[model samples]
Target: MLRRWISTLLLGLAAAALAGCSSTRLVDGQVESFSTLTALPAPATYRIERLPSQQTPAFEPIAALAERALARVGLQRDDAAPRLLVQIGVQASSVPRHGPSAPYAFYGPPWAFGGWYGRPPGVFGGWYGPPPWAFGGWGMGGPTPLYRRAVSLVLRDAQTQAVVYETSAVHENVWVSDPAVYGVLFDAALNGFPAPPHGRRQLRLPLPPPAP
Candidate 1:
């Protein structure tokens, strides 16, 4: 009986490995989008509006990823004659195997990516950049810990300065690397584009191919 059980477990592991080799991992998140713009502005151009925290060069990589997402969604980047103002935010904090997490814990409820709750002004505004905790060995050690991560984008009319669209995407996972999954997060955030569905929904997109 013991021998049979061992063989069965080995076969199951082998089958899973084979499946992974040919399959792409999915980056899944909960997305919520709201849009007041009935129609996109003519020319459909936009520019990135960096927050105070996003002014540094450290944020370039995220901006690049966001640009790709924008392009995919049919929005063009034109700083000179932009019709839209775009702002993007990414934040993550470590989550223990057990206990309350800080980023979204203290409040009534935790907020996830692609969505936002009506929290105080400083909560999301203050900590929208890189996390203070190091992510050095999150995946290296046994029983990798997970992170509660979120991404959001705010779009405003350039001329009127009124927010016309807002979308956010939040996720939780063991992967601590941001750049690797950012494009997908942004894509998920902007899933419905100019006019998304009314309420929150889940999205799963193919993760980028593994680094060579």
Candidate 2:
């Protein structure tokens, strides 16, 4: 009878874990942001800018996600007559689920840009990968891979063209479809925009279901 009770308890625990994993997944994004402005200018109007490499139609979805994040932070997109020019950059890759390293595909280019999170010069298409931590593992330690995603937002003065606010966020998960979680990652990056915290921080948020 004791053995049977033990078996039932183990089965119940397993089932609960499965349900939790199948439900909304939690995303832990590492966020680092910097800014010079204490508050946005009057009207808080801006336009989205992209690099030459990010001008493709394939990048539109990612850009749209960033725009949504900006709006959430009380910024408006005004291309006709704007006060700020917010540039967006993103990076993603797939790695071993157990945090092992192999030849992985990296998005973006190797070119360097000033005011990034200081992750070498390769700061395009991909998140500036400096943190060596991965959480919320999937596949139950099986052969399924993990996905690493990073996003960077650069807010500049529209008239002077000088960078005023810079921020980025990175997250790792088993979900390969980025659209499902990119929105939240952007939210983490711009958590306290205009006057964000000084050091890196960890953010935990629930991932919404994929769009129907």
lDDT of each: 0.70, 0.71
TM-score of 2: 0.72
Which residue pairs clash in candidate 1? Answer: 113-169, 113-170, 114-168, 114-169, 114-170
Q: Model 2, range 13-44, lDDT digits (tens) per residue?
A: 67776776578777899998888889867879
Give me the overall lDDT of model 2.
0.71
Model 1: residues with Cα > 4 Å off, grouped in runs? 1-15, 99-143
Worst 10 residues of 2 by lDDT: 127-136
How high is each candidate's TM-score? 0.72, 0.72
lDDT of 1 by residue, 117-211 (tens): 34332232222322322233333233334556677899989999999999988777755344556678889999877888967999988878756
**Model 1, poorest ten-residue lDDT window?**
106-115
